[model samples]
Target: MISAVAYGWKVTSNAHKNHETEGFKQRAEDVDQKAVNIHVANIICSSIQPLQNRAVLNCIEEKVGPDEKFPWAKFRIEKGFGALEKLLKDHAGRYATGDEVSMADAFLAPQIDAGIKRFNVDMVKFPNFNLENFLCI
Candidate 1:
């Protein structure tokens, strides 16, 4: 059983590596666009993650209550998404950066996912933002 589990883990790891390698190759093909996407992703991370992450939310809920944390997280995510939307409007293609996938898309996709799934953020409010689009790439 142990050996079978180990083999399964190795296979999964290899598949993940292959997928990542393909993504990297796509990003490399458009260096300038990828850089822009990465910059936008950095902004998203800096502006939102600090306030919306699980640790901070847990701390807020512990200190105050669950109701309080939701409002706070919603406000921060909207603000961050506003900026992200503007950036996306200016530079976004099929993905956050451009037609090609990049580190920026990689970073922002998960953040949006967490925001919507965990915090119940209303993503539809951001006209220019689409988590599905980013994730598909």
Candidate 2:
């Protein structure tokens, strides 16, 4: 019988490459509104990343009680879900096959799932945040 470790897959793999392109990147020149949103969201997400990370760290520190720890700065987890969620969403949902399936979608999904479990989020308000979006990439 296989022994259970902690939740979620921890295995590292070069999954993104399967998308058949390196990450999108370019040097800055002009203020494009679309690019600006991407830049802003990343900044926003990074700013609060500390809380969840600290919560993870707190798990190591054993400072807060379990009640606080599980949902510790749960909003941060939610924010991560939101950002990763947007990344998966930007695609037109063409993907629907293969072992790993769409890499970005595969990558974002577990993170989103963890956010849901960790934060107890009510995703209904965000109409765009649908299961179809979740299923597709």
Candidate 3:
């Protein structure tokens, strides 16, 4: 559990890529909001979830936290995910690009679920990010 959340934290880290793609095509403004970090993180982390299983949710608050982003290297997870929740929606939504799973889905699975329970995040603020995270496998 601690390991799973930590993995998600790593994916959500700042260094992860949320870069604008497709020639920077966006709706409101530049797609600086775009992110691929959660996807990769979820994928790897989600795979580990079964091992952690019940232990994962059992160890939030301390193991996982709020007000920060994920880190590939390692750091304070609670603080990192704390910052990330700010940019996401509370509920997971359909895949960003149709039904097919992308790298982003990987990170979102355990992450959003873990985030909601661990940090008490309000996903409305981070709409795009929220929907993706809210959805289940």
Candidate 4:
């Protein structure tokens, strides 16, 4: 079972690599943009999303109280969103990095969606995230 899972992960990893290779092939060659993209991805994947996942939420609820989860998630989301907003302030155009969708947009899109849909994050607080473009997409 473990071997099968590992094999499946390897296959999926290869597919994802191909997808990213295709994505990067068409992407613009801007080092600053790449840096920004990675930074945003790190913030969302590492800092924000982990805290709000079911396991963590459940742990918080189990350890503290059920009522504590929402506030904990809200605070983390807000802090991360605020950081993202400030980070994207100078670089963002119609999308996170530019008019055309780039690496940052790829990462930002789903996180934004989750923030709005799952966590009920207030969009007004993160104005510079260019929600209009992402929402339409």
Candidate 5:
């Protein structure tokens, strides 16, 4: 995740050069906003991924058995999603951060995809979250 965020910053910086012009100034602002969004998304992903990892799941399954493992994962994910939903609801524009696709979207896309597809999480429960729209973005 750190690598991914670092890559995102590098890519964004290289792509959106801060030239001295009115148009470039606006572009710079957009790039800055994207960096902020990516940082926030990275923070969020860092918080959640640890709880959802194979080792964590294995521990839970060993302690509680296979039948209860799904519930454990679901509970943790839902809790994390609740906090994320609040943040996104307050600040989201078109995607997790804003109108453009940023690092935040990049981080969230695969997580959400896996949560919905692999875990069968009911994403509809998060009314503020637009998974389909975000995925499109």
Candidate 6:
């Protein structure tokens, strides 16, 4: 996953010198924002999303039980969300990295939506990670 994300970044970086037009403001020129974007993306891609993926859920259901999958996925998602909230606490504006929509925001929106709609995540627990306005419905 890391390699894939890195490769995409490299390709995007080379192909588009200015990512602002691509909706990835951090990938444009801001180093710190880029770091935040990468970290946030990694958190969701590496740890959070995989927990609910079909393969992992199947494994858990086979090894543990069908009932355990939701709890396991929910726990990991909340934990990852908490980390993201802390990581972006000082940097986030209206979006994940800043006021403008960036790469992190793009990556996060879907995950947040999935957590709510698919996983039944209780957004009320994550007060700071509220992305209601950022979601496109």
Winner by lDDT: 6
The TM-score of candidate 2 is: 0.43
Predicted candidate 3 versus true structure: per-residue lDDT over 6-116, tens digit per residue? 654444342234432332222112233244334334444534333234454344423655322222112333333444444333322355322333434545556556645
**Per-residue lDDT of model 2, residues 1-137, tens digit only:** 32111111111123222323344212122244234334433433353334445446577348767666655566556665565445434532333111223333333444445456655666653343445656443
How well does each candidate superpose onto the true structure, as a TM-score?
0.70, 0.43, 0.35, 0.78, 0.69, 0.80
Least accurate stretch of 10 residues (summed lDDT) in model 5? 19-28
Per-model clash counts, in order, read: 0, 0, 34, 0, 0, 0
Output the better candidate (1/3) by lDDT. Answer: 1
Which should have the higher lDDT, number 3 or number 5?
Answer: 5
Stretches of candidate 4 above 4 Å error? 1-27
The 0-to-1 C-alpha lDDT of every candidate, in the order given, reads 0.66, 0.41, 0.41, 0.72, 0.64, 0.73
Judged by TM-score relative to the true structure, which candidate is superior, 1 or 2?
A: 1
Question: CA shift at 50, candidate 1, in angstroms?
Answer: 2.6
User: 15-94, model 4: which lDDT tens digit per residue?
Assistant: 44564443332234577876787787778776676765788889878987988787778788889989999999998888
Better of 2 and 5 by TM-score: 5
The residue-level lDDT of candidate 1 at 42 comes to 65
Candidate with more favorable, higher TM-score: 1 or 6:
6
Better of 2 and 5 by lDDT: 5
Task: Give me the candidate number with maximum TM-score.
Answer: 6
Clashing pairs in 1: none
